[model samples]
Target chain A: MAVTAQTTKLDARKLRADFPIFEQTFHGKPLAFLDSAASSQKPRQMLDAMREFYETSYANVHRGVYQLAERATAALEGSREKVRELLNAPAAREVIFVRNATEGLNLVAYAWGLNNLGPGDIVLVTELEHHSNWVPWQYMAKKTGAEFRMLPLDEHGELDLGALDEAADGGNVKVVATGLVSNSLGTINPVEKLVAWAHERGAIFVCDAAQAAPHMTVDVQALGCDFLAISGHKMCGPSGIGAVWGRAELLERMEPFLLGGHMIRSVRFEGTTWGELPHKFEAGTAPMAEAVGFAAAIDYLHGIGFDAISAHEHELVSYALDRLAEVPGLTTYGPPADRRAGIVSFNFDDIHPHDVAQILDLEGVAIRAGHHCCQPLMQKLGVAATNRASFYLYTLPEEIDQLVDGLHKVKKVFA
Target chain B: MSDGLDSLYREIILDHYKNPRGHGVIESADAEAEGQNPLCGDEVSIYVAFGEDGETIDEVKFSGRGCAISQAATSMLTEMVQGRTATEVATLDKDELLEEIGIPLTPVRLKCAMLGLTTLKVALHKAKGTPLPEGIAGFDELDLK
Candidate 1:
């Protein structure tokens, strides 16, 4: 879908009306939700689609010869096609449904890393990765006795690409795993370049696109990464559903992470053979309803257009940076507005982040405050925790105004 | 501001947070234990020096970083536990601490308020080999090890 400048300028106020959550008030004030990085509030279209599917065509898929079963199977498979189009993958078979991005990353670390990596091999990850991205590889390295190296972040919180290149020089690097965007810092790394560098070293690249897929467009073929993982809940879909898109050849070669009823071609006493590309990864009964909801979310985002969403978020984040800078002693993290997504993490003076979050909560402004599942990154930043205010397509400028005003109140309370 | 927020962040709580009591460690401490709220990354360390009797706490102090509720509660706990027997500190319950804070905390924030007390109990446990009194918020979950 071609998005013009006119489409890029979304009427977020009008869009907010479509989300039922906005209609409710907190403490007799409009809810200014700034925690989209944690999980986005769903739109009515997605809710209605899931409801319609369950109410009308609920059945076990790929088993019964009945019409309901056929419809259910079609819906499930059709969601895969939607995911393929969303990520611009080569085929639907490349899209495997998992629980969430954590599960998807774990699948790769178990199914692929166990089979491929060994003592002499090295798995390089970045300090910018979320715990979900970091812990799995760390566990894998420990299990396989492979050396695990972390690519450090520069002072600007961007990934040190020079350092990554130096580490990859050894050619012992078998896997290069990192995030497309830093969830805590909001720093958008040079993923395309990293992918090419990994390819040159004959190493497989894995992009944790959980944060990137929601805020910007992701084309797997263009990225040329071996695998990419995405979460549905962060992108306005259900929580228990996500997708892992891998190169078909690599996926076919890897062993199944989880084995059970549906992921088998045939079961016998002698031995059992695995099913096809996507189904080989998806074991047992799948999250059929959540996948349907995810497809509807994709349609909702497409209706808004990613180009438009990106532009809107860019505007919001730029505005937020300017406003947050005006708050005294507010030290923001990550690169400048141009290099980041819609996330702004900061700490106000010596006031603890939890206090800032609580004071903001009093004013009906919601934000996340903690280590944000990136304790190692928190240690790197020289802080225990930070308050994060993240935006989405529906976020309005007035909410940021409320955030600044709330921070002022926090300063007053603590002062 | 809402009354709920005011009650939660009372002036006394802010005062304790700003000018904390026993803010430094006891250098020649007999026993020391650290507690962390894994949810928000709030940490508290309790250091105790037992008296000649080995039951009375001669000196008690805490040093850590956390939210206002945690810091203030820790400061208050230091004041309450000083000169008390390790057994008394060990038996101190969550209600006594909550009453001292004089605020109604949500289930989640209760962990923050009790961080100092929990760490103290762990320290007392280490010093006197006394078990932590049951019903302290997050006592079981606190990884003092």
Candidate 2:
């Protein structure tokens, strides 16, 4: 797919202007936002699309006969179609809308694992997984009396693929779940090879694309994963909206995660018949405007083109790694720049991550400081917490320079 | 360089953090309690020894690892409550500890500032049979009051 002419020639400085939050000065300086992994700043296009939906075409979807309801229903389904394209799923019916990636993962755990998994079955996850991906399977294993195993990372902060093969050699692995990209360490896993391994073991693969979907091109079909989950807020869309794309046959065989108004074909007093495919999974009133915003965000990302976004981020991460290495006592985690996304997690020698974050905040540089919902990963890395700086399309090279300047200030203060 | 940073990381706090007083465990302590800020992975353990009367804290010490504010606050807390009665230590307010640190804290940092006090209260409660006050130990449900 060719990128539109306008976006192919995009100037990031002008692109930054589209996000209104950038206009506001922080601490009497330009806000150097480096926390996009937590949640991305929304562009005007997404905001306007959501506002336009609520103002002009506001109505309940699917059942009402009114014109407004028809428009809303069309828009909602249209967004699903957009998501299908975004993920390169075979069909629109494979796209299931949920609250966020957490909810999407939970849905898979409940709907699929609860039914298919049993005693002696193993659900394999990695230490690199966010708590969302790890905990759901942990709960599922406990609830279903199955075994939950975690593949440990090597010293290089990359998943030990050898361990994965050894663990799956028994063929009891029912589900292989892992993240496409590590939110904390920024290591990008080889999902294509992982999916092939899972298939060879007769196990289903689930990819948590919460970090990958925003920064890279995620083609679920090309990766050949059984299920992939993505978050909307991480991709410049509104919060409380995310999607899961599953193989159509698998979605058909699995039961619904939630049951309510829109997800039923017929609800009798005694028993209820579930709706078809995606609707069966998405129960109750859906996030209509959020879905619209998600579609707009997809359009926005498409306008910029994934190739360009990936190339830009590669350069940024390379530069950031080189620049961050100059700071004394600064230690970073994750694979080298080529194997990672734009995230950089590090800590100064003696200064705690929280203190570093606090000091950096004084310079109007926003970075994340905490366990980053990867406590297991943190324990494995032998660190209490790390300061993470993540990048997005709007990030400028100068902002990274600013971050280096801020780190120097932190060193001086702690010295 | 900002005044806000100066207030948050005062010289006294940094001094205590770098060279903590009353650090290390009381090997023969009567009671001990450990607290952790799961959000930032800061941990503090407070150990206490009751005086002959078994009412006053004969010696109090803490051993843990955390940020500057948390460690310094723990060091300061051991010094502040060493000679006080267990009952008095149990009744010590969080504000008094914050005032002792003499720095304005955001809600997030307030938990760090109070980690030592919360651990001290728990240690006192365990030693002197005082009731454990709610919302003092858990950072998730820390009562800012």
The fnat scores of all predictions, in order, read 0.77, 0.77
Q: Per-residue alpha-carbon lDDT of model 1 for A325-392, expressed as tens digits? A: 88888999999888899999999998999899988888999999999999888989999999999999
lDDT (10s digit) by residue, model 2, range B23-105: 99989789888888867877888889888988888888888789999999888888888788888888888777888999878
lDDT of 1: 0.89
* Model 1 regions more than 4 Å off: A1-7, A169-171, B132-145
Per-prediction TM-score to the true structure, in the order listed: 0.96, 0.95
lDDT (Cα atoms) of all candidates against the true structure? 0.89, 0.89
Report the C-alpha lDDT of model 1 over B112-133, residue by residue, as the tens digit: 9888887788777766778875
Q: Is the docking of candidate 1 incorrect, acceptable, medium or high quality?
A: medium
